[model samples]
Target chain A: MFYDRDPWKEQSMKSRTSLKDVAREAGVSTATISRHLNGSLDLPEPTRMRIEAAVSKLRYHPNPHARRLSLGKSDTIALILPDIANPFFAKLAAAIEKAAERHSSMVLLHATFNKSDREMAALERAAQNQVDGVIFITNRAPEAKVARALNDFARAVILDEDVPGGKVPRVLCDNGLGGVLAGQHLRAAGHRHVAYFGGGADLHSTQTRLEGLRSGLAQNGEPAYEPTLFVGDHSPTSGRILAEEFLRNADQETAIFSGSDELTVGILEVFHERKIKVPDDFSLISFDDARSLHLFAPAITSVRQPVDQLGERAVEILFSDAWDQPDFKALTERMPVELVERSSVAMPANKKKRPEKQL
Target chain B: MFYDRDPWKEQSMKSRTSLKDVAREAGVSTATISRHLNGSLDLPEPTRMRIEAAVSKLRYHPNPHARRLSLGKSDTIALILPDIANPFFAKLAAAIEKAAERHSSMVLLHATFNKSDREMAALERAAQNQVDGVIFITNRAPEAKVARALNDFARAVILDEDVPGGKVPRVLCDNGLGGVLAGQHLRAAGHRHVAYFGGGADLHSTQTRLEGLRSGLAQNGEPAYEPTLFVGDHSPTSGRILAEEFLRNADQETAIFSGSDELTVGILEVFHERKIKVPDDFSLISFDDARSLHLFAPAITSVRQPVDQLGERAVEILFSDAWDQPDFKALTERMPVELVERSSVAMPANKKKRPEKQL
Candidate 1:
């Protein structure tokens, strides 16, 4: 039979030896054996030997799920993110995985692709598996149910972008500062009107970035006009769509504050196909400098998120011992982000044109 | 007790009910209960009802490990790849994860980062977890022990690159074809002499690609000279070092065939820093068009691996019913690749210069 070749057969058969049998053979209470097996208790050498001998005699392989039940820890963390194919999330996940390894924990990855249903399904699966902690990341403004599902976990951390109603510690890049930097750079480059290409209008990151952009563009006084908004999801395909729209509706906007490198790639593709030159035609600043942007045609200017730190800190909070502290869930950490000025941003082509009214 | 506030406490207490207790209450054999619970048995309605009633009465929650033990299936697959942060591997993983999801299986990810010890550790962990299948991927040529460990799995598929002595189905891109495509493209552009930037000299890809390059350059006649080799691990840093070496020893080689986009990025960085223009100072072609090469300054020409198909096929092989067929383990499927002709390649500037004696 094909099943006969299964290597796990013998192991499964051995695992049939019950904990009760081992306890009975060791002449100890079930609690003692359970606690000792999970390394939650200290036992004398003689007692430890007896339990070990009994386990060996019976060939008892403690079931991982039962051990999890007894210990209330799974040694596994669920990393729920938008997409693994995206370089930004992929790098973040790598950092989290490395950090989790240091804590002797494994990461169960679930890619939601920014869909609500998928997000909920991932959460349900994580809960079913009883992971010790969860690191939740989303690009769009999640629904209330998403927040509730996140809150259900005893140990959860919101990462990258915010989930408005989630009652959990958050590890995020300073999105506002990223916007401020982009705004200051563009304004300094003699751009009076700029376009903000974002993932979603309702997203916390989008709003926060917009707020910071306005402050930065104020330039110690009121600016001529607010930046125009062109919103789409963070995928490259969305970037293409937004770029087409921006090109068609171009009035006086000379610079773009892209929410992510993903969008910048798409925008650049469109611009390349149309023979539109960057900087000379439109200055662009991308956030989340996760890709090899420095090697691009014009060498893109970007706001570099502390991606490694953001990921490591998220895992750190997940495995931290301070979960029980008062108001611990209320904590929010905004890791610093820096602007990498490359060759993308430049002066507006038509300096004589007045700034258009804000949309 | 801190454990009192544990959210899983109530669930854990209920899960203490044993399978034997449910079997006894239902007046059935333990094997029958196990088979029925695992959906491996067809029972009468009354019998199924009695078992369900007893389970509900006992508040029994079947341990996932015990269920796996009874069924000889974990509904999990382990993906052992070099690095999750690398875009190529990350995209491949995303495709694998999506495909595995269609089969109702979960993925357990372990990033070895091209380290032998970590590779062995990941394999050991997968074995301990009793994953139903494994998809192993490594950048460098692995040790014999690594191949042996991979062979130990009943269902394992070697992916992306070859692992010599591995007795399992392999799903890989046709490296020879990729090389031939790159060579022909460069040769067509009037490039008699070329430099091949490779990851490792011992890697199967390197050897196969070099062979194809020779034949392609021959083009039904003896080539002017064989392509010189500058080897380094597939990384941007390696690209930079190789670029420096190429510049130092360069004679009449006006074109380069980079083994991966990773190396191409590094090469570009060095070229940019040194003010050496691509297709102007040096023509270039890259393999693994996994990055956004089209957006680069001079869009890079590349051989595009069917990355998504390779990943999907690996998972398909892992779950296929063909594992028991004769010669199935000896199967190797090499997916085709295509040359994406962009702006990277150009005619040699000093066509009159005699090809320097093959380095």
Candidate 2:
């Protein structure tokens, strides 16, 4: 209850000259003064001098927390992600940091390591801190409780993957398009039977991408077989386990579409240890080319997420004034994905091993 | 001055039944209760029950910020680093976060991008927030003003590289040993004329490692040539520029010792684009094997920094009770490094190209 009203807000309000007071004395909009103080704007010399004079007269030091107190903001954003060790999330954090700095906001990081309890704990802490906004990223299919907590924030954005029950603005890469690109690439290379490796079977990304893969494989209304699904968490350990299982149970799968680079690392490690050569033994494609995939032993081809754009857009949405609109909180923006072609994908060696009509 | 005394601390103290009250009721030390509440200690059944009973009777909820007020601490640590997008720093942050959680503390991240002004700003912000501790990391040789600012904190750590005048505990990788390993490896491969690509000419790491390289190269009283030095910041862009300069001005250098993996990425990019081959055109070794070096195009050899150990130790020292000791503030811990042998190092192809007895 001590955090219900930020204690700093109450103390600073009674002592400091507020931003509203400064704006009134300077005969300018509070927005203009804020933008100028944050070094995000340039005004006419006369206007700037007038604001400076007003600031000097009032002894109004624009401490970010104190200034933002008048606006009921924290000047901080809580960034909750599955793991920062993952290159994708690290890059996302960097972009978000850069974007937030432009608006004079700092990021507080909470790494949940894909645990449900940790996710809830981080959300609660964010709420207690009264952060101005929140950016939630999860690799797993989160529980409805997690979504409900996220919805309680004044401003929150779901990023990278989907949270099924969340009624907040969402920014995600086009996973369906990523799957279509992979399916078409594999199909063009004379591969019919493929395996889809995904993080979670119940995840929105996994389902959407799977449907798109089915559509892609069924070129010109031809009979399309559902690709074999291998479900695991988006981690290297899970990838290793799934790779081993796939190797043992293989019947006619010729190529593999890995859900993430984390899994690809595990699959590659297993392949290298067991002397199973990529493309020579099985053609492979990876998603989220956040790592230096181009420098890998066999320059991997991957679906590259627009990481910078996604991060910048998420922060932009969090700070945007459009939140007052009726449907703004329900908005979902999907960024485009691109395929980076390299040596990892090739014509499958077992092109002729499978029968044409196996039905 | 607003944060001179934490406002939350004041508010929480007046309203809540303190940890001291619980300790008094349970007939146990505050330390025991603190550790128990953080779930860091296992207690005997009777003692645990008594503590639980006392907690319930007093309605003493151990909210982290409120509970820590009694101990004159914040349940937060400020992690200031150069860049989070870099794999080495990202991995370091992950380790620090894991270690902090063991003691029920949270990490607040500040990425400075190796800028002096930003570093000072982050430190000032940490002081304002009255964080429990600070972990400062900078890649280049920092200004003296930066060191002075760091010295103001009661519990601050200098990590990775040195701050010239900071009177505080430090935790860094053994740069000398890393250089020795690289030098010895190259010497055994019959390379005498080597190049050292360093982050900065005046950086403590660069100087220490350069001395070690000289000593290692002079094996068994043999004459050691002063290796060529290519000075640049630890970044891919800088690496590319330095690599170009090294190539253009090479006289007899047959190998390179890169400062960090960030530089290696840039050098490798340049090499790949220029059709130069690792260990063929030039043998090379990189520092900070944080990236997937074993899976590189040539499987790069690198001196591996003990990143996890360094992070864990920094946090441990920050929370350690040794701070009251007279000499504790001057303590410095250097973690060991090892060379990861891979395909990147080989006997130089220009073995016979250099003239013997050039002097």
Candidate 3:
């Protein structure tokens, strides 16, 4: 196969000079040369100069594979996310890659698609490759084993959402605040009853956002009613399914807070098909405004995550010198999010009297 | 400091068995064992069983680094792309990653962001890593040196846009066909004078699409007018600039064939800001329906690239056994594109007679 004669093999064969050759010419042990080259040893000036001259004379370059083996570092970070095709995650990956580059590191991407087995496999592979660190992003609430696997890494940052038992620092958008903003906006627009469409009820973001929604809906000392919950994965398909259920079982709910733009797309698709008007029949607000929501049919109202900042901060935290600090691993950095007001939200429709039941 | 004690290093230290250990135990040469493990050597059943038993008894595991050095294959593919943040590229990458996984190969992503230096650097890094193959994707026309660097790879598949000097298999959507579809759609709607928004005039896609557009616009028994070209990089910002330029220089062009949805977003933004209506003021058609175009304010008419097929085919070719064939390197696979009709196109507006020259 052509791969058998690859440049690495050809170069190795063409250039026969090895560390032993340099050591022989420098009149030093191979160990000394290896240690010196890897910066693990400090030799006298004359000896160092002799080794350098011999290395230059031989034109010997250290094998990267061997160097990696010795150093136990790959100069790479692994980005484990749900799906790379998802615009939100794609944008996040781009930002993480850019930030990793600034630190002279490359990113190895793994799209688990929010699957547990895939997540475990990706983590194991990252460990096997001895990556410098990992930035883990999962949409679903992960199993304990997944958290354990993540914790096994020397450095890993849980990003976008939380992992229940993950000991690593987390960088996430303020989901509660996002919910609060959405709730306040809905309440101000004269919406009292609303539904929260979430990925999973157990997800930290979902719980926080729901809590914030309740708090924000409370107006002028009135007791806040818990918004109805519709749980599904953070996908457009799930959005479609949830939207259907919402329509079929809607009970005076006048607004909805979609968990992600992905779901929002699904909801809108069904609505558009069914001729359900937005802000008239139902007001909506989506999270993770990563898509071109501004160009949507009615110009979607959304709670915008600081995606760029979240990704950048995750990488920064992974590579930070403060990893050795006692509280660093337990730290959680919640970047702020803001509500983008567009034409999607409006006052609820006029109440209609219900007819008496007839069998 | 934590990197130095990575689990791989710890494991390596705990298990000192090498290929030599297994070879000695099996009474076979190291080369035989290596070749057997790599599936390069066919051995009798007894010998194979003996080797397996020896390996298990000695608990010998091949060092991935050493194995890579010996085989000259990294079991990894490098995907060099312009940008991952772009939906088109992101979708393409997702498909490629999924396909590559089927072949038990991992993808190392490199986002060059359409820079010559970055392209060169990524290629060099891929070479250094001894990747099994490379899938190169660029938006702009690359310099000859970049092509040369790409050519140096044992196997590379030029994807999406063309690299003129690259001597490798290519997998790209039929840009000319896409243009023709758009042009025909517009021409049918009574748009004789049209404009093209391209990434760059020198780009292969741009030239091919322009050619197709000209052909499509020239219907039977009708004269064809060359569409005015507004060139810019495939970005929303560029779209905005080009739209402004098109407006400033508007003569009689009644429609636009935007190169990509990225550009379409920018044009729409500018048009929205200026209170211009699509299909009312000017008909429009966008290329690369990777974004959620269906939900756009006025669902955009676009040419859809077979992104999934393009990505899957690229990986299939990369790993195919046909490399030894003489014609394989010269292969160019052009996936067909389809025009997705929506409400964005309409008949040209009735012309208002210009005021008689009073000057």
The best candidate by DockQ is 3
Score every model by TM-score.
0.89, 0.84, 0.89
Q: What is each model's TM-score for chain A?
A: 0.88, 0.83, 0.87
CA RMSD, predictions in order: 4.5, 7.7, 4.5
Candidate DockQ values, in order, are: 0.38, 0.23, 0.41
* lDDT of the candidates, in the order given: 0.87, 0.85, 0.88
Which segments of model 1 are wrong by more than 4 Å? A1-7, A10-37, A41-70, A351-359, B1-7, B10-37, B41-63, B351-355
Clashing pairs in 3: none
lDDT of 2 at A296: 91
Candidate 1: Cα lDDT at A222: 70
The better candidate by DockQ, 1 or 3, is: 3
Model 2 ranges off by over 4 Å? A1-72, A350-352, A356-359, B1-73, B350-352, B356-359
* Model 2: how far residue B205 lies from native, Å: 1.0
Model 3 DockQ vs. reference: 0.41
Of the true interface contacts, what fraction does each candidate have?
A: 0.42, 0.32, 0.42
Clashing pairs in 2: none
Q: What ranges in model 3 sit over 4 Å off? A: A1-62, A351-359, B1-63, B351-359
lDDT of 1 at B101: 89
CA error at residue A287 for candidate 2, angstroms: 0.7
